[model samples]
Target: MFTKVMVANRGEIAIRVFRTLREMGIRSVAVYSDTDRDALFVAHADEAYSLGPGLAAETYLDVGKLIAIAREAGVEAVHPGYGFLAENAGFARALAEAGIVWIGPPPDAIDAMGSKVRSRALMDAAGVPIVPGVTEPVADVDAAREVAERIGYPVAVKASSGGGGKGFRVALTPEALPDAFEGAIREGERFFADGTVYLERYLPEPRHVEIQIVADDHGACVWLGERDCSVQRRHQKLVEETPSPVVSDDLRRRMGEASVRAATAVGYRSAGTIEYLVSGEEFFFLEMNTRIQVEHTVTEMVTGLDLVREQIRIAAGEPLSVAQDEVRPRGHAFECRINAEDAEQRFLPSPALITAYREPAGPGVRVDSGVRAGSQIPEIYDPMVAKLVVWDVDRESARRRMLRALDEYVIEGPATLIPFHRWLLRQEEFIAGGALHAELNRMADAPTPLPPADGAAPAQAAPGDEAPEPAPQAERHFTAEVNGRRFAVALRYDPPAGGGGAGAPVPAPKKRAKRSAGGAAGAGGATNEVVTPMQGTVLRTLVEVGQQVEAGAVICIVEAMKMENEVAAHQGGTVKELRVADGQGVAVGEVLAIVE
Candidate 1:
């Protein structure tokens, strides 16, 4: 084993790698941006280095700076943990040139599978089932149309060099092709610096299944099994599970073999995931992720393999620890990406400080979190705060455990997808494992968008001043009837002329009232109830006495997992009262304001 390893990443993945390194008696080094000076991972590592400013381009993405840091730390190897520089082939090659160990696949393997276009051709040549489409970048709209015609309608225009669901568009009909092609090309250029794009037949209602493969430079390789990540939004995975409910044992073995072949074709070493789009019994290769995955925790839970450890050993020129026959994926495992997002609001990012951090625990539950109480989630990176994983003897037990874990998870900062996951678990189609990728969209009750404030308006301010003027009050009364009873709650309105509360006095209850009585009694005043739209801490309350706000206008921001999401009014209303102040911890649906 190497004496020390520099982790070229941040957040939960950094911490995860550090923990494993410690277990293996290897020293771990962490690099962080300015915004992450106080991050949990920094403290977890044996040594740490600053990587400049908060933005990824300045910090994590700065390959030269990272290389310099690794040299300064005297580390034998650098571990790129999944994102940022993890999949950057140039970074891998640069490390190798600098005489430092790169804990991932060979640069050639990354280059082979890095480009979607190249990967498709390679897979095709290897006799792998690939989605029928253009093998090369389309020449023009006419060329694109021809490819679409051959591939059939409902094709996707995808950037040749793209990931994270960016630089891709779906054309449902012939009329949508031109725009889809152009938009995909534009996004491709902006996101990847590559305007080249190709066409592929879009598989509607497809299940996102991927096979995990581990290889040693000694020509030994084994397939770990399969993970289903169909639960996604905008092509980004939200939840991933192993031993897919949709894939049979025989199908898994077949896919595993194909993945091994793909890896073998490239002389792949280290841990990599081969992603595939599965529709019914038919499976098609998507692309290969040539690094440890965010959802690797689920695979670990089921396979009992320390994938990072294996990656480290492989980098050290170690042989495969287990043979292909010994690698068996037993039981079921699920990983919920505990992102700083509001599931109700189309899974929008919710970034805020973590005031109270409560992780779920019990049988078959594991929380990989990179945060602690008082941690300020920076807004310059991914929104994933943690990963909640659970394992059970079977899928049903795993589902039940996941539901219980989600319910018990107490993150009183940015809003999270706990409720959304809760709703998904209860869904009949989801429970039956019949819910396809598009079925979630077709479901009627996709958790109503966060309810709006009753009578809130935006605040405006004079030039050169900091605050915007408080919203003017509306003369509408607000009432809530919970459980059949009605209560009189006061709704405060904007002040008259001198900037004071002159419209209505906000009623203050001496003690907590009954849920039914509280809802019924509050008629004209702002109620005490303030629900947070997502998991995160209250950064600041942008409202005060006599301030008014319109429905859908931002009332406050709850930061979770380092992203600031605007908590908007669900309905037009005036500001009743600011319930939480700056730095207050809040849970999802833990009322943030009572708009009247």
Candidate 2:
């Protein structure tokens, strides 16, 4: 076994790796960006190194810097934990050339599965079932349109080298193909540095299922059952559970065997997952993740296997510790990605200081987090704050335990998806194991509004008469900046009779300046402008000055927290001014372009 291993990641996954390394008597090393200097993972690791600024491209994704750090720290092996450079074959090769063991699958395996087009071909040749679509990369929108026409509508325009819901767009009709194709290519190049893309048949209501496989250099391979990751939003998984409610014993056996065969065909080793989209009893290959997944905890809870430990052992050239026949999964488990996002506002990223933090405890519950009180959720990386995993003897018990754990989990200073998870647990369809793709859209569009606060009630007034004031109360408290100086203020209001409050009401706080719905006024009138809906980088500007556009036309694309959002014009007009250019940083409500 290796004596020292450096985790090339951050947040919950880094802490997760550290815990397993400590148990195995291995000295864990952690690398952090400037913004993460005070992060919990840095404090917990046996050794830590600086990785420059918090920008991912300059810090975590810088392969050369990571290799140099590993050499300096005398790490025997490096574990690329699931993001950033985890799937980069070049980084793995670089680590190997530096005489350090890479605690992941071989670079050759990552290379083989790095591109979706090539992986589709490889899987087909290996006799693995795959979706019906073009296996070759399509160049430009015209070529994409032809391919989509051939494959039929509702096709997925996907980046050849994309994962985790990035670089993918769906074209449900012939008219939508152009935008989807261009958007896919631009996002592919921006996120993965690869512009190659392909077409695939979109599965309308398939359950997302995957088989976890671990292999060793000595040719011993074992398939660790399966996980159902169907609970998703915008193609990103929000909830994952082991032993899918829809997957039968016979189907599980078949899928496990197929996964083993697929791994063996690619000469794969270490821990990996082969994802599939299953509808009814039929299943098709989605793609392979070349590292430990975020939801691996549920598998560990049910199977009692440490996937990271297995990965390290495999990288050390050890044979499989457990054989296929010996592997037995015993209970149902659930995992919810506790992200710092507002579930009511389309799951927008909510980065702020964590004033208070608490994790749930007791039997069948585990929390993997890297933040505590005073931890700031930076906007540079993923919004996932922690992972909540729970286990029980059966699915029902596991569901109930998850609900209880969610209720007990407390966090402040940022909006989280806690309410959404709680609501999902109580849904009848979710409990019945129904696929949630369509239902999720409906929920996001019109979520149930939260109830009023305790003791709060609507005020009733008599017709035509001035409402009588009952009492004065402070309704809201916040801080504001005046002329570059900050001051705390409270919003006060007088309530009618029967309201519970005492004393005279103080004046309300001054209101902040509000930007006009339109942009800067032109000579004719106020120019209608398209503004960014969130803080992010401008990925592209789709409109130019003097260009005539219609209402709802997309004018630009803004990427926030790694998710791309289209900024569209509000009304039909001619483009008057372009305020921002590509690659520029923008704040929420900042005007991007003006249309007159």
Candidate 3:
């Protein structure tokens, strides 16, 4: 085993890798950006290094900075945990060139499966079942339309180098092809830095299943089984369970064997997942994730395997600890991704300080979290705060246990998807083992009722009686420095009581008037400003000052959390002023342009 290793990632995944390394008697080194200075993961590591600012490009995604940190930390290997540069062939090759072990598949394997178009071609050559589509990127709208016509209607325009549902769009008819093609290309270029896109047949309602495959450089490989991630929204998985409700023993064998064959074809090693789209008895290849998956917990819960440990051992030139025949999966497991977003608000990101936090425990419940009570959820990264995983004797029991655990999991700062998960668990369709894509969308469209207060009492008087008295307040004080000046701040929380008297008055601090992002009133004191819907970077501006545009015209593109969103005009207008330019950082509601 290696003496020391550095984790080139952050959040729960970083802490997860640290735990396994500590158990294996290996010292773990962690790197963090400015926003994560006080994060739980930074505190959990044996040693930590500062990676500069919170912006990903300046810190987490800086390959040279990471390499220098690894060298300074004197680590033998680096683990690129599932995101950032996890599957980057260049990063893997660079690590190898620096005489450091890369705890993932070889660069060749990553490159082979990195591009969907290229991977489709490779899979077809290896005799793996693949979706019907062109195995090459379509250059423009005309080419995309030509390919879509051949593939038939309801085709998918997907980024050739994208995954996690970021650069994917569907064109259900010929009229939607132009927009779909343009959107996919923009997303591809923004997220993966590759403008290549391809067309494939889109299955309206297919179960999303994936096989967990672990391989050693010594040629020994085994499939852990399959996970059903059909419960999704916007093409991203929300819930995942192992021993798919629909897959049978015979089918599992076939899929597992095919997954092994696929891995072998790519010359793959270490932990990876081969995703598939299953419709009835027929299954087609989706794509291959050349690193550990977020849903790997469900497989570990059922198979009783330490996948991270296996990855480390494999990278150390170790052989497989168990043979194919010995691999067995027991019982059922489920993982719910708890993200900081409002389900009722179209799943918009909610970044706020976590005022209260608690994790469920007992029996088979496991929570892999990255935040605490005082942790600030930064807008610079993914909104996933933790993953709630549960296991039981079977699928039904696991489902029930998950519900109980979710009720006990407390989070009290930003709005979260807990209520949505609760509602989903009670749905008849989900309980009956149905892929609830359309159902989830319908539920999201409806208003989600707020969860009841943690603890409350019923009224003790009749409707005509006076209202109950307010509770006494608790005051907490803190000291802080701002701009070389020290100030004391006090917070008061009111609890229920039986008193009606007014409370003591506290001196109020001086307040400063703030201007809205729309800026001062425009011409005729009637402002028509275009604002950013979310916090992100301005990738490019589509219009110049005084440019006339119609309603819904694209004015600019903003990149946030690795996804690009086009900012459009709400009404026909001329661009009076462009307050933002390319490469500018913007906050939610910040004005991008003025229209008049």
Candidate 4:
């Protein structure tokens, strides 16, 4: 086994891998940027190094810098805990050249499953089921139109190398094909540095089910049951559970068998997942993730296995410890991703300092988190603060247990999904068990309930009035450069209730429905000011200055925290003035346009 390992990612996954390394008596290294200098994961590492300061591209995604750090730290292997360079085939090759073990599938396996287009063709050749669509990249918008007509409308335009809900667009009509085609290509190029795109039949309301399979070098591979990730928003998974409520014994067996075949076809090794879209009795292929998944925790809770350890063992050339028949799963597990987002505000990213932090404890409850009091939820990375997971004898029991745990998980200083999760758990749609597309939409469009004013613990928002946090009780930031290096310093002081100092906590924004003329809100409501819900870059503007539009028409697209949010007109008429343009940075509640 390797004596020391470096984790090339940050936040909870970094700390997660460090815990496993510590248990195995292996030293773990952590890499960070200026923004993450004081992050909890950095403090948890046995040896830590700085990756310099800038966007993710300059820090976490810089393969050359990462390899140099590994060499300096004298680590034997590097483990990418999902995202960043986890599935990067070129990085794997570079690591091999540098004589460092890449604790993941071989470069060949990654390359085989890297491109969505190629994987579709490979799966079809392997006789595994696949969605009916083109295997090759479409040439242009005109070409995409042809495929849409052939496959019928409501087709999906996806990035050739997209995953985790990054580069996907849907066109429900022929008139929307051009924008969808262009958006897919643009996001593909921006995120993955590849502008290639392809089309697939969009299953409008299919359950997002995936099978987890691990393999060793000795030709031993087995599936670890299934995880239903149907609870999602904008294609990003929010809730995941093992032993899918919809998948039956016979269906699970078939999906498992098919997953093994898919792995074998690519000569895959290490940990990987085969994601599928299920409708009624039919399941279609939806790309493969050639790395450890964020939801791997749910699988671990059910099967009593440590997937990270398995990845290390496989990387060390060890054979499988348990055979296929030896795999026995017990209990039901559910994982709720506690992201720094406001469910009432269209799931907008709400990055801020966590003023207070606490976790639930008891039997079968675990909180895998990377933040604590004073931890900064940086906007430069993913908005997820932690994952709250629970296990029980059955799905119903697990659901109730999760509710209790969610109530116990305490987070302050940002809006979160706690209230929405509590609400959804009690809903008939979730309790009865099935796909939750319509129910999720309802929650997404409606306002999340506020905590009762009787001094009870808050499940979601902080205790404040209904308005944008005024300039603060006062939190101010400054940049300090010492000896040629820069540092970001933020000093905040929130006084006791009546101090009325500069840093008092700001009131939560009001519900979207109550926005009157001239006031800042998430959306345009009793007024014509089309406002953005969060701070991000304007990816596109759909309408012109004088373009006539209908109520609820999409006016622009904003990219924040790696997710695309559409800014729509509350009561559209004519776009009298356009205040923003494409590729511009926007602030929260900033008006994008004025429709009169």
Best-fitting candidate, scored by lDDT: 4
Superposing all C-alpha atoms, what RMSD in Å does each candidate have to the true structure? 12.0, 8.6, 9.7, 8.6
Model 3 C-alpha RMSD to native: 9.7
Q: Lowest summed lDDT over 10 consecutive residues: which window, candidate 2?
A: 497-506
**Which of candidates 1 and 3 is the stronger one according to TM-score?**
3
lDDT value for candidate 1?
0.76
Taking all chains together, each candidate's TM-score versus the true structure is 0.77, 0.85, 0.83, 0.87
Model 1 residue 355 distance off true place after TM-score fit, in angstroms: 1.8
> Model 4 segments beyond 4 Å from truth?
442-529, 543-551, 571-577, 594-596
TM-score computed on alpha carbons, candidate 3:
0.83
lDDT of 2 by residue, 141-245 (tens): 888888887888899999999999888889898998887888788778888989999999888878999999999999888999999999988788899999999
lDDT of 1 at 289: 93
lDDT of 4 at 507: 28
Candidate 1: TM-score? 0.77
Quantify how close model 1 is to the true structure by its C-alpha RMSD in Å: 12.0
CA lDDT, every model vs. true structure: 0.76, 0.81, 0.81, 0.83
lDDT of 3: 0.81
Residue 515 in candidate 1, Cα distance off native in Å: 32
